[model samples]
Target chain A: MNSVYEGAIQDLIDELGQLPGVGPKSAQRIAFHIMEAETEDVERLRAALAAVKTRVKHCETCGNLAEGEQCSICLDPRRDQSTICVIEQAPDVQAIERTHAYRGLYHVLGGAIDPIRGIGPEQLRIRQLLARLQNSEVKEIVIATDPNIEGEATATYLARMLETMNIPTSRLALGLPVGGDLEYADEITLSRAFEGRRIM
Target chain B: MNSVYEGAIQDLIDELGQLPGVGPKSAQRIAFHIMEAETEDVERLRAALAAVKTRVKHCETCGNLAEGEQCSICLDPRRDQSTICVIEQAPDVQAIERTHAYRGLYHVLGGAIDPIRGIGPEQLRIRQLLARLQNSEVKEIVIATDPNIEGEATATYLARMLETMNIPTSRLALGLPVGGDLEYADEITLSRAFEGRRIM
Candidate 1:
């Protein structure tokens, strides 16, 4: 946290350090960058920072980030509202969209269940998801959460709860990635790939 | 410059990308961090960013960054004003201070003579430095610029100018570092060390 700068320069470093993924050294480096940047450029950055808070809002239906009542995905009429691909965060929605494969809607769970982090379904948008599925024509719920331990746990919990509602639940496949060398694969990944082997 | 967020989020990413050292993916990551950060934290960061430009100013005497007429080092009475250590940038001032070995004052050239970048002696604080040395009680001038080619060129240029004024000039040594392994030392560094070998 210690830096050579004082007053405003030091203050900038402190504030930048509070950001996620930014360490003390990175904060100092970035603060210097801001110090040397042109006035117009810095002003633009400040405006963008402030505008994000005022203009961006969470989607009322799927808990995804949006500029209005709904995100771009939720607002699109061409998307299949009957099938919702559930994900853990907004970034996951972006990743799926980049593939240009799925034409369905999305439901952001806000976060996965992490007992260590004290994050549970109660703290997430699970209630909103259940409420959305109540009176809807939704036939399938695609759980596209990350393939990590926490994601798997959340997927299982949601699948069990969704079983009583008679809605078909599907989890993303857990296996070897495309073009991955078998020799370099981890034990658990290799085992999962063996179990989930497809008939070609 | 691609981000998962649309509207305000994408705008935030674009703005953040303008900062030095931050790439497209880093901009997206930082934008997401700002999105998730608490309102108070983001507000504080904004204020700090704005405060830096408004509050910080270049020191009148040495061209170093200062909150007032002079930098803290220049204002201090304990420093040796008779000997001025000339350096390339403000960060060099911090680096020299960390050593606690030299008690002399500093003269920041702002930048070295980089012909490729069109930065020359005329673009630096060389005029101000000469003026300070003219009617003042400065005895020896230590050219403590970096050991790079540009730094050497700047030092030689300053040396030529100061030669007519009869002020003693010196430079930081170029050789093997204290804790560096001999096996990893480059040829140029080894040859320099050989030339500057100390008598046992």
Candidate 2:
């Protein structure tokens, strides 16, 4: 509790507790760790925080995190310009990039379509994605949103919007994970795996 | 992972990962959360970090965390100065204070003696504790070190040193935790529980 610590220590603990997933005990541990850490290390962390706020910006074209007007993926000429993968956050782009299987451009939706939270199609970057499609020589649209309810809703909404445009669109396949055991798969995933089964 | 993010974002993730219990995935998640957070929130965290480093100082007498020359416990006249509870770190002092059962003074040794880690009595604040004993009207010493090997070793060493001083010295009892199941209690704890059973 704040009462247990002095002014600065309590303040640090309170601030650290505000971060996602960091509870009060964890915040206390972290605060003490920082207090014991080298001055240079604390300065580096502070500098990084300041730099992220000042230096990083969103790509005007795709809404992905970037250093300049466009992100590294959007700026690179080697990435496939004919295909654009749409997804819910900048981190999703990073996750897809880790696989190295896809070399296409990405459109970050900023967030998903959640009716309860009042996040609709307009809250996302759907308009920018459509604008990119209209001017560019893009051939295929890949909906790479998450497989959850909100992501599925967003993907369905995007699919309906693109139906009249005549461009071939696809969604990421849903099935049992690569390394997961069959017995451990949930009912939804088991059904999806069965439906998407193919002959070798 | 650093390759996936821009300069500042990657740096923030790397710094966050250095904290105790935070893995790479958690670091990334926190970094993104910070990126999306309001500017004022980020500034508050930074300010707290800076303030903690600049303001927090160890108590001159007991080595507990303090704002000035002495900690609040050391400065409080209502607390019993006749008894001193000697513990490992400042956090341990906080843990003991939370119970409200002990109303005496505290001496923080900074850490217990671990010979394997090259941390001996010299590394801790044992000398300062002895110095406090020379002038103070302290009648008893309560060793509240952790129950691990290092803590036990430190307590034994202190007891041997204090044996010649004609002062009463004791240790905190060790037994099964209050809410722990008897079947799940470890062998040493169960043995300690049996050894510590009172007549009542």
Candidate 3:
């Protein structure tokens, strides 16, 4: 295996191992799979990789990922401008869209506030979000951050900031899942953390 | 996000999803990870993907993956010439080498004789193996096929074929694993199974 191709395979494995959950074993498996893949398929991935760096850009107003000056949601007239759902990333916007529950625009914050990772409010698109809130036509802002600790802290910080700006803000409700068990709930969970609780 | 990299992420995700064990979620994760990766790292993977096809070749004698005209094992003089251990694939050769117990030469058959898959003995490198046996210096031939239905049938066929050539052959011992429980043994097991057998 100590051949000219060994270095290339090792390099691929190293690159693949950098992924969030991919370990050395998984990286090796993925590298081998890629090696066995068709040339056209590999070219597609290569083209996509190059294209991401060259084509994708942040929307000027809502901070959502867009191919042009603004995201599709911001440009669409059918979407409600009065209600903007704020999220941590572009993928979150896609997740919400998949449900078809919110017929409103979205604001991607890029990431949640994580003191440990040195991610501050200023580093996010919080200022742009505030600018959007300045419009009197925008009646409500929905904080749809993740239910995790960092997400909660960011949401709380944003909510406090919005309150100072005289903007009515709301967060995504959380409690037991639709078919969850109370016994499995942690201490902070069963307390009905969200103010509004509906009996099923 | 369609800023500059319009459908690049989607295209990469689709390509990654085509892998054997990777799903859509994993593919998305991988695509994002690759996006965040450095250009050099991505280029390394691309180079490696191409190198495997250009550099690697099948060994003329054993049919195992090789870097040159023949595999390293086939060229090494320290390995015993009189004994050849037959395996199913190149990876199998690596697995055996990891044990450090076998110092003999090897013969990779490419794949097992699977009738359902239309692979017969003629399709494999069995002819090359017989040619190697014709040399009078060869003494023992070890059948190290996997312990499965197809493997068993292939080994039995090879054994019957070798018996006609007046050569002493042997099969790897099979039984309970070290520190394994008897209760977990299946039907084929716990019967004709060895009790505290010693390796020769």
Candidate 4:
């Protein structure tokens, strides 16, 4: 709103509103707070915005983000080199890590194949991933993309691509979430839960 | 969560999380977006943040945010000087303006008298507002603070202080919102609605 706000404050609000998930009202509130904030505090935030862009880069080998050429996981010696987790984005890497269940190197695809958005296999990091697998002794690849239509499509394509390569590939199982009520489960999820049922 | 993020990126997340409504998860997401944003876009945001801090300041007369010594409202000769609307904060001015109503001068209190948070009248612009009232032809004052405890307290205090000045005072009426459903109305609101019933 034009209101009586100065040009500088309005410009700040416009800039903040461009951030994902921050709408117009939130941007205005944030601009006012930043204006009233301590000089050192705003400076710290400014430095961070500048530093992240300058310091962070994609890990050349795996397509995940990194400060240098290789991500921390790729540089770590203890992670399993024989198995690699394939994820859609760098943030997905963080989500999987929080589970503390995986201890292998990761390959970030940057995004999944979605023809609706004009994104296809060639647009992703699939070529780089194939290159990583060619000379490596990796025996297994875990496709950890979301269970949506696009994610499944990507996983199926990758599985087919690796069939001749002889490296076994698997997808994350679809099931009812733990601690969730069966009544609240959607139809497709219920069917998937049945399909994935075990003898126990 | 730090996960595999570099130090600078993590610092950025922390700084962003300190903003009013942003949590750690949102902060992380925003930081990543900032890192991936175009250099020109990020520079514009940075400049806006810096300029707001350097150029925006409080209006000397009304305590509202201003680029110059006095706010636009104060400088506008068309505004009615006989009627002054007292509000809790500068943003309140915008809210009132958006209503397309009220064309009088405004006095910003900076904040209400919040004792638990250690804020008092002395912390506000009460003295300046009082000085503006002196030897002026102002006929009425509208105490448009919030309807919450602190706002009501401030309004009551201001009304009592202005009683000797013989100028009429008023508050924003509390009632059911225009499009709100009466079925889902809370008790306090329902009572307010009943109390504020108007004759046809």
Candidate 5:
């Protein structure tokens, strides 16, 4: 039987398929799930989707997403201004916060330096970060880009740029996964394992 | 600096993460993509999602998703009422339609009989289907359930139930993937391969 819902369902699948990692099969599954979901649940998602753009804005100081002029992290007086964790995106800030591992300010680059994607240093918030550093309040900068090639390149680029300012820079540690088998380690991982070896 | 968008962005990530196959990383990526998308594009998705339930109905005869009292296949004069292609879900109907291989009517089982899930013949549209068969001119029944264990069990159960009637029944052919290696074929597949072997 021809369904009037056919076109709407197909459109939903197409829109969902646009998302990263959502293949057509997965998109169709999600579309059905959404269709079967409670009206209130679907409406919540729709309202959330619309509210995000209207309510959210970039933090004036950190470029992180915020509701007002200052983000929650920047407004929290207990946070350390002497150190700033530089990341590639706003969600990275949340990832760090979830761990409760660090209580410093954050600088979101919005994206990394991918010349192939036409993203250069100027396109990022690097200049603004540098300007913030010039005030001399931040003594240490943690370059926590992802461990992938692009992330490593971005960190390296930032490290060199911050060198002139004489701010101490560090990258996140990399090695084998915890409880991972040594035999399964690739050559690059084995090299990193050796490079990060301790005297203990 | 704090971002004004942080809370709303995080909310969107959380919502997207609830979808099937969408991991935390993928959810974050999708949230950002939605944020950057054209307002109208996102609204189209929202509208489609909202419209599916409001506009779509189930066909009284076939159980397929429909716009009006009956589905298109049920209403189409060209479709054969003398034969019925029974499938597990609405999307399966679309999958068959895409091939343009069958012009017979459809009967959506809603789901297969799974004792583990507490779903029996009564839970599905089996009663309605039997009622239709009693009154209609159906000569053949095509049990096109998925090739999985539950599908097989459901088909067997239905075949036994339909044994009381005089209509003939058939199942879709199943074997190996088209380009897959025979050496990698599972035991069940190998058994099917031998069982369906040609005389030539």
Candidate 6:
């Protein structure tokens, strides 16, 4: 792939190709774009790359990404303290916040339980969540992990752990998404939709 | 888009979104990936970005990206300098080189004629190409601009300009792409394929 391009350009393309979604062609396109882009824009990207790692750290309480010891959600006095929404990662917290629905505090588990990937209950921040619950007067827990296999496994594990704590625990309902046709829905989703149906 | 994440994370996401083909969702995903990536990887990307701008410069002779005054292709003595393959940009030079078909030298015109973007013949390195031709014993010119409107226009403009030079000039053939289904070929492509048909 670096056969034709010269020294610096080839190096840049190789680095860009290492990104998650960027392929060889896209890496070449981006490297060319950067070559043609304003110096200021490139400098900004470099600065952002440098700042993301050096300035950001995990929240001490929730394990969410934070600038200091605690994340903004943990520091906010206006947010509900009686309930905690347990999720897989910081991006999940961002997604829930975008809906403007959940106002309660959040607990990031870092990742879900996937034995194939060597991730288990001990590998996650479940103990930290339990410790936080013990210290706080939380009355309810919402397990908002993804609807996938790993997420489901994590939710079940967390539910079993929280059952003896006497606090009410719930999982987010799974059903057909809005604006989706019932005829096109997959069997699993359709079954869930039917099982979770409410009398209107 | 930056509603939830803290300073450094939000800044990284914003910068990532500015890249070509990268949307806000992808930006967030990549930013988080970077956040979780090893320090060595992040440092490699930063070094690449910094070195690309500082070390790379346009080829003084052909307008292609080069580490020194001239591009590798321009400096190579084994390449066929008598036949110069004229292309729209440096990436086109790369695409042609990847085929391992042509051994001729290349002349990059920077970009095709784009009136909507206010680019004209003077904006490109056309004069440099003409000067090179006048000073050299070149025999042929291959117009390998893109098959799009701007590329055709640029080819036509160059052909008219090169007519007096008496050097044989040719354009790349237009037809259905290899491995592409004939049924899915567009009307314009089908018409061109017929117009440019060759005898076995």
* Number of the top-ranking candidate, with DockQ as the measure: 6
Q: Between which residue pairs do clashes occur in model 4?
A: none
Q: How accurate locally, in lDDT, is each candidate?
A: 0.87, 0.92, 0.78, 0.90, 0.84, 0.91
How many residue pairs clash in all the candidates, one count each?
A: 0, 0, 10, 0, 18, 0
Docking class of 3: acceptable
lDDT by residue (A31-65, candidate 6, tens digit) is 98888888899999999988988889999999999
Model 3 per-residue lDDT tens digits across residues A78-107: 998888899998778778887778998888
Rank the models by TM-score, top first: 2, 6, 4, 1, 5, 3
RMSD of 4: 1.3
Native contact share for candidate 3: 0.43
The complex in candidate 4 yields a DockQ of: 0.75
Off by over 4 Å in 6: none
Expressed as tens digits, the lDDT of each residue in A1-200 for candidate 2 is 63688899999999999998899899899999999999899999999998888888899999999989999989999999999999899999889999989999999999999999999999899999989988678898999998999999999999988888877889999999999999999999999999999999
Model 5 sits at an interface RMSD, in angstroms, of 3.7
Measured by lDDT, the strongest candidate is 2
Could you tell me which 10 consecutive residues in candidate 6 chain B have the lowest summed lDDT?
Answer: B1-10
lDDT-sorted candidate list, best first: 2, 6, 4, 1, 5, 3
Residues B5-29 of candidate 3: C-alpha lDDT, one tens digit per residue: 2366677777777766677788777
Residue B51 deviation, candidate 1, in Å?
A: 1.0
DockQ of 1: 0.67
Which residue runs of candidate 5 sit more than 4 Å off their true CA positions? A1-5, A174-177, A192-196, B1-6, B198-200
Question: Deviation in angstroms for A161 in model 2?
Answer: 1.1
Window of ten residues with lowest summed lDDT in model 5 chain A = A1-10
Interface RMSD, prediction 1: 1.5
